[model samples]
Target: MTRVVIVGGGPGGYEAALVAAQLGAEVCVVDRDGLGGSAVLTDCVPSKTLVATAEVINQVRESGELGVRIGRSAPDSGDVSDVSTDIAKVNARVKALAHNQSEDVGRALQREGVRVVRGSGRMAGPDRVAVTLADGGTEELAADVVLLATGARPRILPDAEPDGERILTWDQVYELDELPERLVVVGSGVTGAEFAGAYNALGSDVVLVSSRDRVLPTEDADAATVIEDVFTRRGMTVLSRSRAERVERRGDGVVVTLTDGRVVEGTHCLLAVGSIPNTADLGLETAGVATDERGFIEVDKVSRTTARGVYAAGDCTGVLMLASVAAMQGRIAMAHALGDAVSPLDLEEVAATVFTAPEIATVGWSQHDLDSGRVQAVGIKLPLTRNPRAKMQGIHDGFIKLMCRPGTGIVVGGVVVAPHASELIHPVSVAVSCRLTVDQLAHAFTVYPSLSGSIAEAARRLHVRGQQAPRKDS
Candidate 1:
């Protein structure tokens, strides 16, 4: 049997191990961290669990609009102080959920008959891996194929290092004993925006510091505008176009200094600057694998590194850097290496979601792409305010946007901004993947008074035979 050794037990590594084993290959996975990497243990899963709790808290806070009451102190009476949560328990639950998922992944791999080594892995060569065992010695595994899936860690500024007390990284936040009284999040990207909205909803006096004109600068413009509006309306202080110079602890609180000679104080600080791939000293040179200047592995669509028998996937490959993308890349890497039918990674068909309040989910081309003449397509947007379910849920923000080819009318891309936009965007993803026309998408069945109905409505509005003419933006 072909021997496959996967380094790093992340979504990329573990998923590749499963496929390799199913293909009747001898597969071994070297895991330094837990089985699911940070995605399960720290990053995506834990953060989303926290976001889920934040959403629940936000719901209780908004129950006043629906004439809901908790005890004698009703929410409609503006008794904000009555709304509180056991944050320590919530965080504990978040960590526990992550832990359970990691355990589940490990069990799945075991069921697949994949050998798992608990250690740090290094590429000894194009066809070998050297694993440093946790307890004592090193074990070198000879392999016909080697897969590198080492993930990334949160980036911290030199001057704003995390003490794990007053300052924290996204991963370390789950360790907090209580919700920060005031949280100053520095960075307005997806990670920053999600956490900012989460903490704000969790009752922290949140101050978002962004070095851009607006939050989620890389997302859909109208979507970002809506998020920023909601943030401010919910009493979040957003300092836009301001860069954080340094973060320092003062007594029980922390202080953030901006380059523009301004300072902000908060109970805690979160550094959402960015991420650095965990590729340093991985013996990539010895293995004949090539990496870019930033140390991300240079891989083809089939996930092959420069080395002959070596492949790389996940954050290390720098392909979108999402957990789902990482898992897909892993499957492709194993498929190509094991001589199975393979399809190359396509960013256009990938769906991405940002877990902020009134979450933003997008797939394929964006509005910027349309406006900048990158692609020719007609688009239409329908607000969720008109949706019966949204009205029942008291959702006033968010919209559904659908885009299609001007002539062929094939659905090319879509964006859904709503509570559970993640769920609403799947059908749109299917349409984009299948190259379905707007008419076909509109004619699909969606339950009445559902948020998904807005997706169909948006597609119908963009339909060639529809009464409404093709418009640019909503």
Candidate 2:
């Protein structure tokens, strides 16, 4: 039987171990962070759970608009002020949920008969792995195939190190027992935006510092515009073109100095700069695996490295840094390595979501692709304010966008911005993956007074525009 050794217990490594074991391979997983890695134990799961609590607080604050009194008093009693979030309770719940998820993943892997080694793993040779056991011992294992999914950690700036008290990383924030009076989020990317939005909704004064002109610079421009407007309207201060140079403790609070010589004082600062792959000291050179300048593992579409019988996936490979993408890459690696039918990873069709007050989800091509003249397509955007369900829910800031081929009307990509947009983007993902046309999407039945109805409406509008265009005789 083939022997598979997976290094790291993140979504990629654990998922690959299951597939390899089910395929009749002897599988062993070396993990240091219990099970489920940072995605479950610290980063993704913990952050989302906190956001869920914040979402509840937001809903309760809007109870008056729904004609539903929130507290134990009449609507005119101004009971909204009574609605507040307990940071201690929220943090405790986040940790509990993350721990439960990690345990669940461990149970699943164990049921599949995959050996779990509690330690850090490194390449001893091309086909050998040396596990530095958690108990301070070492174990050498033989492998026919080795999968590297060591994942990544938060990128820290030299001048602005996290004290874990006043300054924090995404993973360190869960330990806070109290909410900050003024929270400064120093990054305008998805992580920064999510935390800023969540805190603002949970009754904290938030200031978002963005080096770029707008928040979510990498996302759809229109979606970013809507989110920025919402942030401003909800009392969150957005400082554009401001880059954090350093952070230091100032008497009772923290002070963040910008590159432009301006200082912003806050109760706490959260750094969301980016991440660095966990590839150093792993003996990659001895194993003959190649890496990029930034130390990210260099792998092909099938997650194969330069060395034979070696594969890499997840954030370590610098593919997309998304859990879903990591899982798919892991599965693809296992199937290809074990001589099963498989297809190469197609990044264009990958679906992604940003968890904020009004979540942003997208699949396939983007408006940037169209603007750059990389692809020929026609698109339309429909506001969520026009949707009956959104109006009922008091959600007015968001839209549904659809992009299709100008001639054939094949749905190539789409974006959704609204509450629960993550769940609404699945149908669009299917259309993009299966190469469905605008007519096909429009013909599908969506329930009335639903946010999903806007998806169909956008597609129908695109279909009509396609029909009206002049055609050339061949």
Candidate 3:
């Protein structure tokens, strides 16, 4: 059997192990952390679960606007202001759900006959992995193929280290016993915007510190603007063009100093600056593997590092830095290394979602690509207010955007900005991946009074020279 050794039991590692084992490879996975890695145990799963709880509260807060009384005695007796979540209980549940998910991944790997080594794995030599066990023991394994999926950790500045209490990292916030009276979030990236919005919805006075002209600088400008507008309308204080220079605990609260010499005080501070890849001391040099100046492993389209028989995936590869992308990269790496028919990774098909109150989802080429003349296409944006379902849901802040080829009208990309936009973006992704024309997409039946209908509507508007595809019923 082909021997495969994978380091780090994140989605990339575990998922690849299953594929390798099923392919008749003897697979062994070495992971120091739990099976599901940070994506499950600390980062993605935990954060989204917290957001789910906040969504319940957010819905109740908006119930009054829909003529639904939330008070106990009188219609005004039980207001949404009375709806409060116990931080401790919510955090406990988050941890429990993350732990259960990790356990499930572990069980799945075991059932696939993949050997999981509980330790930190390092490259001992070419095609070899050395693992340091928890009990001070060491184990070594020879491999026909080696995969590295060691993920990343929250990045902190030298002057702003997380104390795990007053000053916290994204991963450390779950330990809070109570909600902060005021939360000052530094960094306006996806991670920052997500936490900042979540805390704001959870009843904390939130101040979002962004070093850019607006929040979510890398996202579509319109989507970012909508989120920022919502944040401000909901009473969040956004300090644009503000950079956090230092974070320090002051009494029971925390203080953040900006590079421009302004200070912001808050009951707690969250640092979502970014992440540092967990690639240190992995013995990359021993295996002839190489990393870039930023310490991210450089891999080709098939996840191959410089070393033969060696591959890398997940956050370590620095390709998109998304869990789903990491998993896809891992699968591709295994397929190529094992002589299975393999296709190189294509990022254009990947869909991303920002799980905020009014979520934003996107697939294929982005608005930035078209606006900057990177791609020749025509685009259309339809406001969600025009959608009957969105109107019924009282969701006024969102839109459906579609981009198609200028001549043929093939769907090139799309964006959905609304509640559950992630689900709505899937069809757009399919259209882009399959190279379907706008008419083909518009011909697809979408239930009336649904947000998905807007996707079809947006496509119909971009029909090539206004010609519609013949429908089966028509």
Q: Go through the candidates in order and give each one's C-alpha lDDT.
A: 0.91, 0.91, 0.90
> Please, what are the lDDT tens digits per residue for candidate 2 over residues 81-166?
55778899999999999999999999999899999999999999999999999999999999999999999999998898898988
lDDT: worst 10-residue window of model 2: 465-474
Model 3 CA lDDT for position 258: 97
Residue 307 of candidate 3: its Cα lDDT? 96
Residues 358-382 of candidate 3 have per-residue lDDT tens digits of: 9999999998998799998878888
Clashing pairs in 3: 71-78, 72-78
* lDDT (Cα, tens digit) per residue for candidate 1, span 115-213: 999999998888889999998899999999999999999998988989999899999898888889999999999999999999998889999999999
Q: Is candidate 1 or candidate 3 better by TM-score?
A: 1
The per-prediction tally of clashing pairs is 0, 0, 2
lDDT of 2 at 28: 96
Per-residue error (Å), model 2, residue 130: 0.5
